[model samples]
Target chain A: MCQLLGMNSKNPADIGFSFAGFRARGGLTDDHVDGFGIAYFEPTGLRLYCDNRAAMDSPLAELVSQTRVKADNTIVHIRKSDDQLLSNAHPFTREIWGEAWVFSHNGKMTIKDAADSDPIKQGKSRHYCPVGDTDSEFAFCYLLNQLKEQFEYKPDARTLYEFLTVQCRFLANYGLFNCLMSNGEWMLGYANTLLFHVTRQTPFGSAALIDVDVTMDFETVNETDDVMTVLATTPLTSDEDWQQLAVDECIIFAEGHMVYQDVPTRPVYLSIEEGLKIAKNA
Target chain B: MCQLLGMNSKNPADIGFSFAGFRARGGLTDDHVDGFGIAYFEPTGLRLYCDNRAAMDSPLAELVSQTRVKADNTIVHIRKSDDQLLSNAHPFTREIWGEAWVFSHNGKMTIKDAADSDPIKQGKSRHYCPVGDTDSEFAFCYLLNQLKEQFEYKPDARTLYEFLTVQCRFLANYGLFNCLMSNGEWMLGYANTLLFHVTRQTPFGSAALIDVDVTMDFETVNETDDVMTVLATTPLTSDEDWQQLAVDECIIFAEGHMVYQDVPTRPVYLSIEEGLKIAKNA
Candidate 1:
């Protein structure tokens, strides 16, 4: 199992506060420290930094934490891969329709490369191939391949949301498939077992971190009309309310607001602790 | 009218010394202060950093200079675009055949997006498209599209060199089109107007930077078996004997040694100053 932290803001915002607390889980408060990566979507380009080292110890991570680069959308991951290779680091990116798409996975999937010969897996490696050997990257490529095969150009936000909901549900059948994806314009989060999100708007109050000795007053950081949404595998703050997504649920947030959501019928709820145990045993 | 710096080494080597000199051109030394970027190829992946700010003023570039991340292959660029946008910053990266390809250009081209309808420009935007409006990126997409159309997978280095030599010459017909490209394993440099290179091996001596006051003793930094080749739009070190590539020349370097070189018949020789004037007027 890994850890994920995603942020989407109506305007460019700094993620240092949320990231400071979340990065503590990468071998400081909890152990998910095979590697770590973060992607910050600048106005027109993306800045990606990945290190095959514990986020708590990596100098690159320290640089990222210290340098407050304002971005519209950001994705961070602390990996727990069996093989500590740089290629397996999360927050993989691919360019589609002249836009860069970033993806990160938190849970293990039972899908194997040998099954790529199946009809469903065809063209997965043809249009977009995984540079790494991780099942997460393989799955990301499959998703992009499907999108490319269906559309010659980038589709509208609503169309993409509808397509992604069904595709994400299908992927969850493979196993625990918690993921976060973004193209800078919108963030899509899917939870098979455990994922939580919180939105902060005007009249915001202070929030205390769960893992670190830090408190931030959102009122001071955000402007009058600012809105932002943050998603994580687990809640990073102790005071604010964080809503857990239902199993097999897919949600899309754009401009700091939830635009679409789909919840499967007869969803099976699972606790974070239970999910961690199963992930460890796998 | 940009600046380029590239390195290929037999062993992972620190490029801080050369980068310090090259970065000065972004603001302190010469006026190419539109944007800057650098790509470092790690053992299994790549780390890319780009900033729209002048390299001398960018904190990110300062961090990059302070943190000496060793890499086997590296590419850096300081831009001078009319529109100083982050998207126009080089070096640009694209994934081809599951390998990340990095490219940076220092010259102007007359190629326009309207030319996509031409037979020679077929699939240029379909297979790969430029996110920015720069002619340099458009040319890069065209190059990659041509390579993809011809080869299903990454071809051998020799075959790629031969194919690229022809393609680069064809692109030069549009205008000055000097560029450097790499896929981590090898580096391909083409000089339509101006380019220079220097190689350092055992028994290396000290060299002084032309832009900065720093000097480095290569013998103290490199091992006996280590070899490195540095390529740039202009000679960076004052004391080293740099070799200038002839116009319409294409060269490939791997493991710090030149693997292939092609010089066209009746090649026109242009000085670096002359090339810069032509680029600025473009």
Candidate 2:
């Protein structure tokens, strides 16, 4: 399994504080260190930084932490690769309709099985293809292909939210599918297992990091109108109220607010024996 | 007009020395600083760093100068944007046949006129499209599209060179067309106006930058077996014997050696009056 961190803000804000704690999960606090990547959506283009080196030790990541680079939308991933090639690094990006769409995944899914059912493999994804050999990239390409096939051009936000929720649920059925995706404007987060999020606004306070000996006073840095929402596979802060998402849920956030969410409507119970078999196979 | 710098080496090598001088052209030594970008091809993937800020002032560029990140192939550009959007920054990248193709251009051409004749604008470029509005990007899309239509997948290097030379000559007829392109394994450079390159081998010596007061002792840093070829809009070093490319010349470099070169077969003479009219119209 890997780790993910995403931020969406009404005003551009730096992720240095949370990234410091989250990057520790790459090797220091916990062991998911195969590679790491981060994507920051600038006003007119995207800046992507990725390395096969452990984030805990990467000089580039250190520079990122030291510099207060701000962005309205950002996504970061620390990977423990099932596919150990450098090409398998997270936060893969593809261009669509003149905008860069970025995606990162946190859990494993069976590649052969997913590709067998992917629309991209069925000959619909003529324009975009993955340059890496990871199941995560395959799934991302499939998702983009689906979107391209469904819409003639960029669709409205509500329509996109409705379509993507169903797609995420379908992907979750195959295996663990926690993911975060963005296209500069909005962030879409989906959870099959573990995900947590926190929205900070006017009543900002000091927060302590869970993985490092660090604390930040948000009140000192943020303005009254500043709204920022951060999502992660695990909570990075110890003192903040982070809401844990239920399984098989998809949420959309824009301008630091939850614009849309889809919760599981019907609960399906599985036998313990069946769950054990699924876990064993995975 | 913008500036382009490219490096192709036998072994993975850091471009910090040449980059320091080239970056000076971004604002300090010259005034081409609207934006800047660099793309480094790692063993299995590509790392792209770009910023709309002036390279002389960008902290990211400063960090790049400090870090010794190495690659076998690298391309850098400092721009005075005809279209001042971050998306219009040089060194744009697109993926084809599971390989990332990077390109940067250093001249201006009429946009609407070029688009009218571009295959991409004619709707035949189904596989690749420009995400940015610059004429350079449109030409890149057209080039990639023509390549795709001619070859089903990645073509042999020599075949690609032969095809690209003809295509570039066609583009140059419209206006100035100087560019550098790479797909990790090889680099292709085309010059319609000004471009220079130097290949360094065993008996390396200290060289001073033309744009900065810095000097590098290649003997101290490089192995005897190391070979590197650096190409730029102009000579980056003061003492090196850089070879200037003739008009309508295209060269291919791989593993630090020039594998192919094409020079114009016949030169067309134009009257001074006609030349002035063309320049004025452009």
How well does candidate 1 reproduce the true complex, by DockQ? 0.60
Query: In model 1, how well does chain A match by TM-score?
Result: 0.96
The CA lDDT of each predicted structure is 0.87, 0.82
What's the distance in Å from true for residue B210, model 2? 1.9
Q: Residue-wise lDDT of candidate 2 within B162-267, one digit each (tens)?
A: 9999889877876778899999888989987777899988899889999989999999999999999999988899899988777778998999999999977773
Give the distance in Å from residue B75's predicted Cα in candidate 2 to where it truly belongs: 0.5
Please identify model 2 stretches exceeding 4 Å from their true place.
Answer: A82-85, A113-120, A267-282, B82-84, B113-120, B267-282
Candidate 1 lDDT by residue in tens digits, B65-133: 898888889999998877777878899988888888899998877787346566546776567888777
Which one wins on lDDT? 1
Q: What is the DockQ of each candidate?
A: 0.60, 0.51
How far off is residue A94 in model 1, in Å? Answer: 0.9
Cα shift from native, residue A220, model 2 (Å): 2.7
Summing lDDT over every window of 10 consecutive residues in candidate 2 chain A, give the lowest-scoring window.
A267-276
Model 1 Cα shift for residue A233 (angstroms) = 0.4
